[model samples]
Target: MAAVSPREERKARLAEAVWRIIAERGITAVSVRTVAAEAGMAVGSLRNLFSTQTGLLEFSAELMVERAAARVTAITPSTDAVAYALAAICELMPLTPETRREFEINIALIAETPAHPGLARIRDHAHTQLLDLFTRIAAMLRGETAAPSPASRTNGRRLLALADGLGLHLLHQRASDDIGWAVDIVRDELHRIKSAAIGD
Candidate 1:
């Protein structure tokens, strides 16, 4: 991989500052000046990376999705399909402080989608990427090596909905019990798929 440049690093830090602001003060509080203050930089410096507030918001949302995609890509396949699926899906949720901040930022950007075309495009891309990830997980649950079947596609959509809903729940209700229950639900679904695959 190529080394991260100083300019890119500063932009990422600015994005992090934007997310922190969103997590603490809501989306209305994030501005170039506020983000620069949070990042300990000048507003002009932030503007060098993001010409406008919309650009900053788009970059931050894209960064969050990219991080989640990187996490999913890092997973090594294992024999236990249920465990692996749970792990992969969990990568997209607010399970940790970093991830929680990302989720919060994502939610903030999503709320502004109507005002920002760039954010709307990012949302669409994220939805498609998530469906693709879930489809792969569904195929794994069904013990398939080739293309996903129609049933598998349906199951994938269902799993994505369940996981996304669980993520929203966890965003507001952050508790160990909630996380455990969510994981159990996904595990049960994957197990059911595996059993059905065996029967077939």
Candidate 2:
């Protein structure tokens, strides 16, 4: 890969600062000047990188999905289907500080999508990709024998919803250990799919 220039790196830093401020203090804290302050750079310098708040937010939205895509790509599937499914679901959840910030930033971007066509496209793209990801994970859990049935597709959607619910609950400061709740839901569903595949 080509080396990133110093200017590009600074822009990435500003995007990260926007995410951090959003995660801590909501989108209300994310003006261009405030983001520049959070990034410890002059407003003029930040403006040189991004001409407007919309441009900065678009960059932040792109960065948010890029980070999640990288993590999802890095997941090594497990031999045990349930474990594998759980791992995939966890990739979409806010289990760590970085991922938590990611979730927060994505939510903030969602709010802007209505007014910004660019952001709306990004949000729509992410939705489609994540649904495909959930479907693929469901197929993996279904294993080699059976074809993917409509019920299986529905199950995949349900799993995606469950993961989103878990994320929202966690984001709203639910118990730290409530992740177990998510795991239990996935494990139960995967077990049902596995049993069906085996003619149980």
lDDT of each: 0.86, 0.80
lDDT of 2 at 74: 80
lDDT of 2: 0.80
Q: Give the TM-score of candidate 2.
A: 0.86
TM-score against native, each model = 0.94, 0.86
Q: For residues 4-51, write the lDDT of model 2, one tens digit per residue.
A: 899989999999898888888998788988998999999999999999
lDDT tens digits, residues 1-200, model 1?
99999998998898889888998999999988999999999988888888999999898889888888999889988888888888898788777777767777788889999999999999999999899889888888998899998878888999899887877888777544446776788788888877887777
The residue pairs in collision within model 1 are none
Instruction: Tell how far residue 168 is off in model 2, in angstroms.
Output: 1.8
TM-score result, candidate 1: 0.94
Q: In model 2, how large is the Cα lDDT of residue 14?
A: 98
Worst 10 residues of 1 by lDDT: 174-183
* Candidate number with greatest TM-score: 1
